[model samples]
Target: MAEPTLHIGRKISKVRELKGMKQETLASELGISQQAVSKIEQSADVDGEALEKIAKILGLSSEAIKNFSEEAVFNIIGNTYHDNSASLNYQCSFNPIDKIVDLYNEKVALLERLLQAEKEKNELIKSK
Candidate 1:
């Protein structure tokens, strides 16, 4: 059998897809062509620095992308679900795009609240 680490490109491709990011989008972020991204995805290895940049764009750590694989996923699920006392209660109802949008909105709202508080503090000082 081939070494598990030999499939890093495929792992990157899978995680990119899961993030709802097209190879073209990734290519744009990486300053490479879509064809180049496709080629990298088909290869067994990618450059270390480039991989780190790609992982950041995908909102994942480089190690997460490197270690992600079907076998690993299966192992995690198997271990988590097999314990008789454990319960799997959550469901995935929305697409990844919706999830991302929701996260973005949450961050924006938090930032707006912080900005308002800062403005209030400034006004209080100015009134003194």
Candidate 2:
């Protein structure tokens, strides 16, 4: 069986491939080594900055990476619940839709921050 983390790595790699980007090209754009890019695409643990850079390099909004990670975690939890049904009881007291709404709100907040930062940077450059 494949590890859940590996599944997420594969998903990231798939997205990069869909964008028609090579790992070497992305690494160069991000100022990181190709090996580092490979590690991230493979779902190895990475820092927040690397995640942000990878998203940017892949022509994705940071929110997309955030949402992808959250969805991957949700899938792992769901799969574990089903697989461990014999050993544990899973109760759903909250609606999954509510969680989705919350996540969407979080994504919105992140995008707003990014937008604000860009605006500030632009203003600074104009003032100079």
Candidate 3:
């Protein structure tokens, strides 16, 4: 069987989407029109120089963009989230409520210091 052709444009589009970018945004970055970007996204292949520019805008190497796979990305994300040894934990080690209370206490302490300083200024004014 003949090897299937790689849709470079589609890979670029998927990478752009994964990066939360719009075609208009990519167009602006490339100094091209939105229609041009759309056309590129629909193309089966892209030239090396244009591909380099797109890869740069997407914050990846040309090879990375060329080899981009949605399945690989999802697999990595899934594994990262599921593997506790992967150091990608989202759980907070410290209590958020405690942190909020600490911030509130600091603000209160600052206000108290300001109030004491104002009282001192008032006492000085009275003596004058």
Candidate 4:
């Protein structure tokens, strides 16, 4: 039987994917090239500092990344959704609609910041 190896890079890649982040985005955040990010994903092990930085960028702790298991996640989802008990009550901490509104507001704020940056860039070009 082949021994199972602890692939930290794969865990980081999976977490980044789950968080809806692209290699380019993660690369930019980490101040590394996209190719470097790709290499990291293919690697079996990453150093402690790099792993910590990647974990932070993925919005997770290093321990979370180290302990990540796809099977556990699927099992949790299956249990949560497959439960048919009438007394099984699941209450969300926040309203879904409110979360949607918050996302929209954040998007609008990002657009505004982008517009401001573009305007400043144009002003600089005009002055040159």
Q: Number of the top candidate by lDDT?
A: 3
What tens-digit string does per-residue lDDT give for candidate 1 at 1-128? 44756677888888888778999999999999999999988878889998899889999898889878777877877877865454566455679899999999999999999999999999999999
lDDT tens readout by residue for model 2, 35-64:
977887776454677667777777786557
In model 4, the Cα lDDT at residue 82 comes to: 62
Question: Where does model 4 exceed 4 Å of error?
Answer: 1-5, 83-128
What would the TM-scores of all predictions be?
A: 0.54, 0.43, 0.62, 0.60
Clash list (residue pairs), candidate 3: none
lDDT at position 65, candidate 3:
86
Q: How far is candidate 4 from the true structure (C-alpha RMSD, Å)?
A: 13.9
Worst 10 residues of 1 by lDDT: 83-92
Model 2, position 103: C-alpha lDDT score: 100
Better of 1 and 2 by lDDT: 1
Query: Which candidate's TM-score is highest?
Result: 3
> Clash pairs of candidate 2?
none
What are the lDDT figures for the candidates, one per model? 0.86, 0.74, 0.90, 0.88
Error of 2 at 87 (Å): 48
- Ranking the candidates on TM-score from highest down gives 3, 4, 1, 2
**lDDT at 67 for candidate 4?**
91
Q: In model 1, what are the clashing residue pairs, if there are any?
A: none
TM-score-better candidate, 3 vs 4: 3
